[model samples]
Target chain A: MTVLSDIGHLLLTADLWHAALAAAVLLLLPALGGVISERSGVVNIAMEGMMLTGAFFAVAADLILHDPWLSALVAMVAGGLMALIHAVVSIRFRADQIVSGIAINIFATGITVFLINRFYGLQDVGHLPPSELLPNLQIPLLDQIPFLGRVLFQQNVIVYVALILLLLVHVLLFRTRLGLRIRAVGEHPEAADTAGINVYRLRYGAVISSGLLSGLSGAFLAIGISNTFVPNMTDGRGYIALAAMIFGKWTPFGAFIACLIFGLGQAIYDNNSIIHVSQYLLSMLPYILTLVVLAGVVGRSQPPAADGIPYAPGTE
Target chain B: MAASSTAAAGRPAPPLAASLRRAGRAVAVPAGSVVFAFLMGAVIVAVTGGNPFAAYQALICGGFGLLCSGGENAGLQVSNTIVFLTPLIMAGVAVALPFRAGLFNIGAEGQLIVGAIACTTVGIHFAAAPAPVLLPAVLLAGMAAGAAWAGIVGVLKALTGAHEVVTTIMLNYIAQWLLRFLIIGGPLQLHNGFSVSSPIGAGAHLSTLLPHDDKLIVFGLPASVYRVHVGLLIALLAAGTYAFLLWRSSFGYEVRAVGQSQKAARYAGMSVRRTIILTMLISGAFAGLAGAVQIAAVDHNLTDKYFSDTTGFDAIAVALLGLGTATGIVFAAILFGALHGGGAVMQSDAGISGNLVYVLQALILFSIAANFLRTLKLRLPAVGRAAGTPAAEAPAGALAGESATALADDEGLA
Candidate 1:
């Protein structure tokens, strides 16, 4: 069929791979954050909302400061504040993590739109100026490597940073002492508390770090990929990242792989002109695939034992 | 939340006064949370250079038939509130039912959409059918579609041990996309090239309680403008059914047993898997009925507007705010429906963002989670959960208790 051949041709083209890589990094950041947060036993479905907040703040800051890096930092801080709310409610008050997460999302959605009305007075949040936007790098020597170079080397700076952070998170989750404590806290908080590890603190840190990563992803989406911020511009990418997290069985490296698969789907959707399918129908591919993958893989995957339960001292 | 139930279970008030006091303590937290959020919303409005009082006044006028001004009739606002509340009651029950069984039915939005689509499909084809033959048929089709949509999540959860939250969210996206595909340049698009389906035949329309004559006036509005129909009664009946089925029936007892303790329920000879699946199906049916009612009673056709319909998401807030009680859901739905009705007026009159209502809703949920009012119970004589325990945390915790975290146990076996 024409659709199959067109997809094959698209796969062979370097542009498709390059776009997929960009999209993968976008998902990878949040997926990594999800891995870190869930690994520390806090369920975070609010990544979508947090990322949207980050995207809004990132664009707002960039518009004011004329510096992409500063805006990105502001975005991260904004996300951290949202996560702090989740931490206090779920960890301190022992609220249901799902409810708390959903609340954060709803809060972010309402606050962002409300702020827009206050700030812009019904005007659209405009695009960043060229000089103020995140710059793409074309590695002098590496860019010469034909297909691989175009797909991997010549990309935005955040892409490189995300790849490195992926490695760092992977290492932090598996190789470090703090990582062991976090895993212990997530798996069995009572045992971790008895072992003298600060369960609450680790969870707080992991959740905050997830917010930071998600925020960075949001910044990339606003300044690095898209020029301006739209209300709910992040769309469902945060949820897709969540799917990536589950598909990877909650591992940073495995999540990266899942992100790439989802990214490919997104990239293909972006290039829907070649595919002989409805654009709306094409948009459903990633979500349907997530459902299928979840149905197939969730039975075999293992999450931390105390994953959604709040750890109350002396409860056990 | 688990805290409320635990508090009720832990303490048994002896005298009538003690029982009243206990009931007061239970109502205080949610009521206080709502009040606190409104105060905070007022502050935010003031900070944004808008008059909070005026905005709230507009909200009140838009939500109910009181203090209306500037060409806005009191009757219209009340009618708007009723129309908005109709679907929410059923959708709230949809979310609330699964919460009792310790399952999160986040797929209600997707199910609602499918139900609407099914209702529209049946209504469009059977345009010639009279009211009696058509009404139940479209509603059943919608319910069937909604149940099928939710059934997928149930089966996945029952067999593969997938988290319903994730699956439901995924399904929500699919449903949104499916809706877009159907009405936009797809099979259902209107002939005039609008991104809406053709209006259903007049025979398919629900009859208005008030005569649709301009000569008829109630509260200064023509009866023809009143969109409130028999759907309100249906919603109320659905609420009653939800209460009876969830509280008075043996099946409800089984569901509660499974929710409270799956191990205990299994030991008591209950089939855990069947209960899980059945609860989801019933929940889906309620959500489907909401969608069906929305299409049959209000919209009369599929439109792009359904893409932004927050009925399903609002249902989550409704179910939680109501504490999963039928009376609570009705009251919560009315409150939310009022907020929604008032939002447009606030936007027009106060030159303020309609989204302030959403912010208020979120704030209320946040305050509920914080359970700040639970501390008040401590001042009362030996009642409520432990000194610092969140008394409002029980129901919400139960929501995620069995399903969200249930997969952890199986992860070990795998």
Candidate 2:
């Protein structure tokens, strides 16, 4: 009962909601990435690796260049390169996408640590100065609004960017001709190929785009939310994003809602000082919730029809 | 009939040649993958301004106890490799069995963790029992716990048509958090120790192969320095059991039939759902046995080291590289065990990060999955097109087909 009261009181505070939105945005970026990649018929379980790679390069670049924007760009490129390996192996060579994804994850973990050892002599990556970190934007007048202002207006620049990207992805995936073609290709590549859609080109583009989004999320995590890059700093956020994608049934808006739920859990865990619950047990909630969703309590969540199948031309 | 008889007599030489070709092709892809990975690893090391040769030399010295420049003992190193590979053999069987059923068991890590937890709980509770009673109790407890953990996945998959890959991933995280909860502040925590459980009783320990005696010296070191335990024999027995279960049992036939085509299996009067559930139960039991043995033979308690344990993940590569055969799995386990043993030496002696092992592992996975050598048209004379295709295609095909069938079933339900 005390725990319930604690959570209830915490929910009413603007600070909790503010932190929740920020965390949700963090998960939202990769969840959106997952949505794009899986919708293109490529099973992308590699966002965790891509995000880790992005986070490492982002911190590394920021240390060298001292510019957050440039560092973010470097991060995206690094993530895209990792994804390119996955795309080439799974899409071009017709390999198992899951195995390729696993390889990407393992490779990212190894390369990042190996680079840290080479550059920093087995020491920690030094923290960035406040001036070098991504700035928080205070929307002028809107910031004066009571509770919603702190929750929505005065937030990290990346949070705003992510919210905008969320809208753009929603519109792009459902409201455009390109979106239709992506869905068609995912549903039936052979039929789409017959319809003159370049299935390979679309899949490659979708996969790379997922990497870019995941990279941006990683940059936000390393440079905005935190100042230094710890080993495995992303922890399992990328995987949580995967859960969000599935919980939302692969739609951008659906995934966003799922992210908010998981993000709330993260926010609550962060405020564990007041809540009388084990943080570790609290941490398991997202995965448990996802499992519940998968168990059909939330209705069946179907994937793209041709997802995970290698596109062999002229095959049935 | 006359022509057929003449051809058979004339082509008598072809039988021996064909068998040789068959054996050659079996060894080619996995060998090629390892070579490709090592070459790529060398390139990565060189590009990063490190001496690849020095690093590899240290690795070889550490793994096989040869060409040592660091004054490490050859006998001790071999013992270390054996210890490292012991659990991997069982875990490899865990992954391999599920693959034979067309189910990807990515939750081996989770299963192993719960098994460790259960084994610790039982061993601690039964501290006063004799070795004859406590030893088997702890191991069976671990197996039961692991099976129950994985049974949730099997039930969901069988009833709801949920994809095993996604469910397994979720379960892995859940088990990780559960383990943390158990040891940190839960009942399993030791009195004064941090992030560790109390050691099990002496009766629960799986005695080392060598007598624990500081006075006895072998190969210029105390016999106690060698940590190789009786788990090696258990692991080998487990491998033999896996082979027998997979090749000679009626259950194995059902599993393979379901793996080949679920619809055909269902048409042939086998319950696909039951086989799916049973395969996961058995698979999880193997993984659980791995954890129980590690606790009994090596660690003897739940420790922070288990947090970063990669034995289950390494088993995936072992199963793949071994081509899901008992002998192949043993050989692959040895290679991986050697790499792990060598990694520490490489880090200390060559000033290279031990993470290079993981990089090499990832490269091997990429090469194997993509069949890069085959794609480059570097086919060996023994690898006929048909023979090479099945080995590379089976895993991918089975996974894709299983999910497609699951999706179709879901649509019918809807």
Candidate 3:
């Protein structure tokens, strides 16, 4: 009995770090997309669809190509293509950004299912073998440390890359004039235009960047986290990431922490004494947390002034 | 000058005509797009070597006309249709309500399922007594539970400044899981089976109405035709209540005011937080009621599949179709119910892919959303900002100032 309890305790304790890692990966996609959103002055709500599409493609590639790395690459490309459609519809045609994003999601979900069913003769896909997976990396000295080693050091490449991107994003946004321009366009594109920055060009660039990052998230989820994909597998993580982004008040570093909080909430629901609750309800934890944060927080960190507003040249 | 005065003349017929024209425009894209999409879906079914018409027939018969495959044209068919329509109505309202406030409540699926569970618990536990007392008590409990679930999101948005679209969507998954837990491990455990289900006590299950008959009566004739249940009445009442709240009350006014312009509403001295929270709660309650009715009236026991299904999300499509009105919700629900009813038919007999329904629905949403955006009118107070495009015109009685931002750049690249 004591041994069982101790094992249970260890599992529970270890789950927290696992939760954080998962949450961080989830957070990485939206934070990356949002950084671009703030830069270009739009919200990337279709992230759920994009990530789902990428996950499907990642698994599809691995199944077809039998190469995990190549599959991940293909997934990224697929994600990029999905985002590109969104950019064109919302940014170029001057469609409502949120509506456009939703459309992209609907499109991606429907298209992926339709195509996969056609190609594979069914809905579900086969899993990739271990040799086809992304190999995890370990930091030599640091990986030998106690708690941090397992939590931070000995994770897959995506986690390390996500952390590195977090810092790099900070530098790129705060240090570079281009970052200033992206923020400028996001907040007030008319002002950016006045300042000689091409608002159209900058906004387009931001949305594409969002696509790339979100795609990476999807690819990582399929290839690194798991070696398979099912229909609509990302299962609202993109939306959860959206919550994390807002929870962190839309700042990258802040979003990382917020994502971790969401991850913790997810872990708690699973590990809690309320073991009788449905997994469906348990999955809603992060969303519930996001709602709490959104409702509780003041409108302190506002989106750029022109964030969802379309920028037709000469209108302002 | 002459044309301008003519445009202004005698309570202009132009607005009505314009709206009609806009409505026409609205239906066009969806019609074309859906036709094309269905054509594609048909191709899919054909490719799969299924007869499209046979599938459509099967879908209609299976989804609405019968509980069991052989039950078609039996007394139970009509009851089945009403059974399917009940939650869809509530969910449609749930989706539409948020949309009216320029919000989206994607958590309806979660809210409905949880609400259903809450009602089922009360109904079952309380059912050790008389029917009349237990029924009303369960209904109230269900409503409260549903309201609480939805109200959480409302409260979150009010306090934290989060987007309801994302949060509600996330909450949906949690709700599904929670429903599963309750069913499989807790009070909802079934009577000796591997399936996760509950045993609702006697007198707690919803009773259907056939006016003068207890058995299924069709059109006041001989055979048992499905009559409506108390849920239909409750749904109707909810719709009427929403209409009253949205169009007539101060709170509704404030909600609309906030949705139109939160900054302006603040300037107008309206309590934005209270309105956001209150509206979300009310809408959520509606979703919860949907679940209650489904459990108490339709399925006596809980199923995890029902909790996690797309009904709540599909309600969003319904709400969009309904123009965010309660009356609209009813029609939207029926339309969606039909599609759901038709899905099996399309798949098995008609040689049209069952997924065509989703494609058509998505097309319709895209069309409505596009038309909704295209018809808005946004004019700035400043002189230099008055270059109004036709896409920004206000349709009669349709709220203006969605004066949407053309957020995309359309650089459709390779």
Candidate 4:
């Protein structure tokens, strides 16, 4: 009862809401990316790898360049390059996407550590200066509002960017012609190819776009939320984002809602001192919730029709 | 053509030569993939301003103990590799069996963790029991825990049409967190230790292959220095069991049939759900055995080392590179075992990160999955003509195709 009251009290606080929103945005970006990538028929379990690569490069670039924007761009490019390898292997070579995704993840983990050893001589990647870190933008008058203002207006610049991306992705996936083609390609590539929709181009673009979003999320994690990059600092957040995407049925807005739920859990986890539950047990909640959702208790979640299948020309 | 010509001349081709040629063809892709990975690894090392040759020399010395510039003992290195590969053989079989059922079991890591947890729990509880009683109890307990862990994935997949990949990923995290919870202040934590469980009783321990005696010296080192244990024999036995089960059993046919086409298998009167569930249970058991062996022969307790354990993930590469054959899995396990053993030596001797082993592993996976040499052959007609026999498609191809239909069937259920 005390634990319940403690969680309830924490939830009522403005700080908790503010932290929750910030945490949600971190997952939202990648969840959105996952929504886009999976909608385009590529089973992208590699988001974790792409995001890790992005986080590594973001810190590495920021340490050298001292420009957060450029560092973020570099991070995105690095992630995009990783995505390109995944694309080439799964798409061009007709390899197993899951195997490719696993390879990408292993590659990211190995390369990041290897690069760190080479450059830092087994030392930690040092902390960034305050000015170089991605700034928390406080919207002047808007931040003055009681709880909503603190939650929405006073947040990291990347949070704002992610929220905007979420809206844009929702619109782009549902309303636009390009979005239609991407969905068409994912649903039935052969039919889409027959319709002259250029299935490969759309898939390539969708996959790269996912990498970009995930990279941005990584930048947010490394430079916006935290000051220094630790090994595996992203931990399993990218995977949680994948869960969120599936939980939301691969819709951007739905994924955002799912992210918010997971983000709330993260925020609560951050306030573990107030709660009586073991932190490790608390950490298992998101995965458990996702599993419950997958167990059909929350209704069935379906993937795109042709998802994970390589697009071979003239194939039925 | 040579065989055909010889046969046309009223005599069959020599059995040895024909078998040798067949074996050579079987070896080509995996061998090429390894060579490709090493070449790519060399490029990565060179690009990073490291001496690839020196790094590889160190790796070779550490793995096989052939080229030793660092005064490292050869016998110890080989022993270290044997210890490293003991669990991999079973874990590889775990992954390979699921692939045979067209169900990707990414939860082997999770299953292994739970197995370790169960083994530790049982061994600790039965600390006063005799060796004969405790040993089998702990191992069976481990296997049961692992099976239960993976059984969730299988049950959900079979009943609700939930994709095994997503469910397994979820379970993996759950198992990881559970392991953390158990060792770090949960029921299993050691009294004075942090992030480690209490050691299992001596009765539960698997005896080392060499006698554990400081007084006995072999290969210029104490016999105790060799950590290779009876688990190696168990692992080999597991591989043999897998081959026999896969090739000879009626259940094996059902698994293969289900893997090939669930609908067709169902039409042919085999229960697809039963096969799927049973395959996962058996797969998990093998993984559990791996975890049990590690506790019995190596770690002796659940430690923080299990937190960063990549054996299960590495098993994927092993299963794929091994072409899902028991013999191939053993050989692949050996190669991977060498790489893992060599990694530390490379770091210490060549001033390169041991993580390069993982990089090489990923490169090999990429090479195998993409069949890069096949593509290279296509581009070069000269090369293509030389290898007239088409490369055997990897078993992963069957898995890849089956997953698509399986996923499609899920949508129909929804």
Candidate 5:
């Protein structure tokens, strides 16, 4: 009984809610990134790198701008810039999309480490001042509510923004003409192009959107839970987001739920038995989750017909 | 990875003559991709802060300079590269093989771990045997273990219609956890004060090669001590044999047929399910050999990081670069080996992080992927794909007589 109550107390803590909020943003971003990028018939697998890139820029921006909101925007712009690199290489150079995505991840990982070492002159940097930290927006009446308030209301702007992005992605993908064109491109780029849709334009749009959402996700990582930045901080969360996207069959809502579950899985696992579990086993949570999700959605995931396939003019 | 059927909606197969043409065309592109890949690598080195000439020299020196110095260190360097490449080559081939059949096997890391666990078990318990026999037994045991690991993925793919990618990945974690549990608790327990390593038996070790000259000279100076073994020969033999199997056998033909047109293959009486499972098993067996070699030659015991890093995921890149041919995979693996070998030197000499090599590798992969996407005007970056394009990639750059860009399909082949 004591152990059970202890577990309960731990679960209901402020830190747990923060972790949950953190996890939810990560899960939702990639799927939204996918949909937005799918507008051009591409699925950005470099979300990992973009998220990492954003994390770095978010801290850098916060350090310079001295405003958290400005820092968040900087993260988005940085992610977009990273996505732009991907876009040029993949769209123009006709590189392999998956490989291109991997390059982004690798380069981002390297550059971040290099810059951090140069800037901080150490293995890691200390946290920014409280003014630079994202303040929680607690609802007045909702604060009176017990568990619900803790879980939902008292998060930084990024958390609330994450929820808004989820709905926005769903609406953009399912309800709007822009979404239709994007889906069409993903489903059949050739047909979409033939129907007078500018395929390159769509792809550019998608890559840009991937940058934006992934940027937000990155911001959430640096400021939402912890007020410090670290290299490889996003770690494999981006890949897990990819898994969640796949598990959700590319639906924004589905991905949100999957992300939440993964975050919870991380939260529970992180708090509950990480130490007790084998270090190797514990480290492999995201990959395992990825595999499970992949398996679950395999055969069912009808990725846009042209998801990784680039668009060409004369080719069949 | 869309499902391919041997008998799409019901139709007979095409003429054998066309199959011959496909066989020829299939051989051509990967050959081209290889030369093209090398050229790209050269270009990338120039674009970075380093000279390609110096980097290449460093790479060549790093890989073979040890050998030129004479006796043991050279042999050791050779063997280490080969030993490392052995698993990479096997995993590369494993991935590439299924790829020809239009399948993706991204679970090589997991599968390799499972195989290693089994190999480690052999190293820990089995004693009282000579080097040759014990090593062979361990190798076989590793093969069986790895094969079973791949087989699990195969079975899942077959029965539940699950994607091999997901199943194999999940299985990798399970295998990893299970091995750790077994190693910590029961039969293979290290039981040695918090160390997560098993006590490997001396008898179950690889015989020393270059017994006399274990330490060799580098650049006219005798420096660096290491040993070499028979693993290099094994790696070469494995690559050659895989090449033979891919091009010479009826099974190879069936695999190609299924890959090119599953429905047609099915109409022609090919067993899609069996092939899928068998392909994964073959991949596993090869991976197991890699594990055995790593144990016998390098680490000599089951340790933690042994299961993790090695960039087994990058083997997919090697396979893609190789375009699924044995010789291509061998060269690609060697290239990766050299890259890894030179990474430390590059970082030390240039004051760049060893990860710069990764960045360069990623650049090369993404650029090629970018080249592929140009056709579709869809651009993205390959962060560190190292290599990409399972199909048509090798067709252009790998084969001897033919040449083409492997990046075509990755960009907009669909």
Candidate 6:
């Protein structure tokens, strides 16, 4: 009973909601990316690595270029390159997609740490200046609302962008002809290929787009949410995003709802003092919730038929 | 050999030669991958303005104690390599077993940790017990815990259709955090602030390869200098068991069949779900043993070091580069153990970062999966009809056999 009230009281605070929204955006971008990539029949577990690479480069580029937008662009390009490696290895060479993805993750970790040590010479990558950091904005009239304003209207620029991308991806995946083709390719690549849909191109495009969004999330993590980049700064958000994607049944809107739940967990973790329990136990909540959700929901979720199988043109 | 003598009565030499050639090619692929990865590493070192030859020289010296001039002894270096190889052998088998069953068990790391935790708990709680009784108890406890951890994934895969890949990765994080919780102001923590557990009683310690007395010397070093333990023998025994279970046993035949073609296995009256769960249980036991051995033989307690344990992850590469075979896994573990043991020396001697080894491992995975040489064989019409053709065609055949299993594991979750 006390625990329930504690959670209720915690939810009542606007700061918690805002933090939850921020956390959701962090997961939402990659979850959206995962949805798109997987919908095109490519399994992308490399998002964690890609995001870390992006986060590293974003900080490096921001430190050198001093422009947040340009640094973000650099981060996206870096992430796209990693994704291209995955696409080529899995699609072109017909390697196991999961192995390729795991390799990408290990490569990202090694290269990032190597570069950091080589470049910084044991010095820390300093934090971005507040003036140079990505700015948070508040809506004009909506900001005047007592509770909702603080929770929804005022947020980092990336939060708004993420919400917009969520809507755009939903429409693009469900409503657009391109979206239908992507789904068809994932569901039945041979059929799509026979229909002249060019399955490889759609898959490559979807995967690279996922990289771009993941990179954007990395940039936001470094410059928008936190001031500086740390090694493995993205942590397991990329993986959590993957869980969100699975929990959402591989849908943009569904992923957003799942992300909200996970993000709420993270936000509550961030404010652990008020929970009146061991902080260590609190730290386990997100993972435990994800496992419970997966055990419950994954049994019912139907993924694309051709997912994780490489398209061999006429082989199918 | 006895059957071959009768079968080859007419042309025994040719069949024997063909089998020898097939074995040679199997050895060559992994060897070529290592060389190719090293060449890539050289290029990276050159690009980074480091001396590639000097770095490699340092690695060899550190790994084998070859060409050592300073205070470093070959015995100590060899011992370090063996220590690193011990856990890798079991972990490698843990992964290899699953690969033969067509399940990618990425949760070995989690299984290993739970194993270590279980071993520590048992050792600490039964501190008064004799080594004869307590040692086996802790080891079995670890195995059981690890099996249970992996059993969760198997059950989920069988009943709920959850992909083991995602579940395993999620479990890795959970296990990591659980370690932190236990050692940092949690029940197992010895103090309020430290991220470490109390040491287990001495009875839990595995007998070292060398005598405990520092005055006693063997292989040009004091006995105490050798950290290698009886765990190495246990690892070897586990490998032997893996070989027997995978090749000589009926259950292994079912596992291989399920891995090759789940539908076919089912048609042959094999319970696909039972095989998967059992295979996972055995694999998890091996991984758990690796963890338990690591704690019992080396650390003697849980520490922050276990939090960053890469033994399970490295086992993935060991299983792959080893081509999912027991003998191949041992050799692969040796090579990786050498690299890990030599990493610090490369950093200190050649002025290159130790992470160069990781890059090399990843590159090896890339090149191995690309199967460039095999592709060349398939492309060349001359070679296509010759000795290399059948071997080149084998992966495709294997893929076809495993496709149903892979499909069930990946896309059939629903």
Task: Write model 6 residue lDDT over B1-414, tens digit each, in one string.
Answer: 334545767655566776886788788777887998899889988887778998898888778888654456788888999999999999999988988877888788999999999999998999889999989988998899889888888877766666777778888888888888889888789887788898887888888988888899788767997999999999989899999998999999998887777777777877778887898899999999999999999999999999778888888888888888888889999999998888778777776677777888887877676665665565677744333222123222232234334436533432
| Cα lDDT, model 2, residue A158 | 92
What RMSD does each model have against the real structure? 3.2, 3.2, 7.2, 3.1, 8.5, 3.8
The segments of candidate 3 whose C-alpha lies over 4 angstroms from its true place after superposition are A1-23, A106-109, A121-123, A138-153, A261-285, A295-302, A313-316, B1-83, B156-162, B191-197, B209-230, B248-258, B261-274, B350-353, B372-414
Q: What's the distance in Å from true for residue B277, model 2? A: 0.4
lDDT of 1 by residue, B1-414 (tens): 434565678874456766677677777777988899999999999997889998898888888856666568888889999999899999999999888888888889999999999999899999898888888898898999999999898888877777888889999989989998888888888865678987776666777768889998877777899998988998999999999998899889988887787767767877767788888888899999999989988899999889888899889889988988999899999999999999898888777788988888888887786675654454477773444445224565665455534444444434
Better candidate number, 2 or 3, judged by DockQ? 2
Sort the predicted structures by TM-score, highest score first: 2, 4, 1, 6, 3, 5
Q: Residue by residue across B127-223, what tens digits does model 3's lDDT show?
A: 6868778777777777788788888777766655455666676677677667766666655677444446655666776776655354644745444
Model 3 RMSD to the real structure? 7.2
Question: Mind giving the per-residue lDDT tens digits that candidate 3 earns over A204-290?
Answer: 788877777787788888888788877777877787777777777667887888777667656655555635445655565666666
Give me the displacement of residue B43 in model 4, in angstroms: 0.5
Tell how far residue A94 is off in model 3, in angstroms. Answer: 3.8
Show where candidate 4 strays beyond 4 Å.
B1-18, B376-392, B402-414
Instruction: Give lDDT tens digits, candidate 1, residues A101-218.
Output: 8888888888898889888867488878778888899989999899999999999999999999999999999999989998989998999998899898999999999899989999
Rate residue A166 of model 1 by lDDT: 96
Expressed as tens digits, the lDDT of each residue in B138-247 for candidate 2 is 99988898888888888888888888889988988888888888888878899655999989988999999999999999889999999999999999998999999889
lDDT of 6 by residue, A233-258 (tens): 78778988888888888999999998
DockQ of 5: 0.36
Who is ahead in lDDT, 1 or 4? 4
Cand. 3 Cα-lDDT: 0.68
- Clash counts per candidate, in order, are 9, 0, 68, 0, 80, 0
Docking class for candidate 1? medium
- Model 6 scores what on Cα lDDT? 0.83
Interface RMSD of 6: 4.2
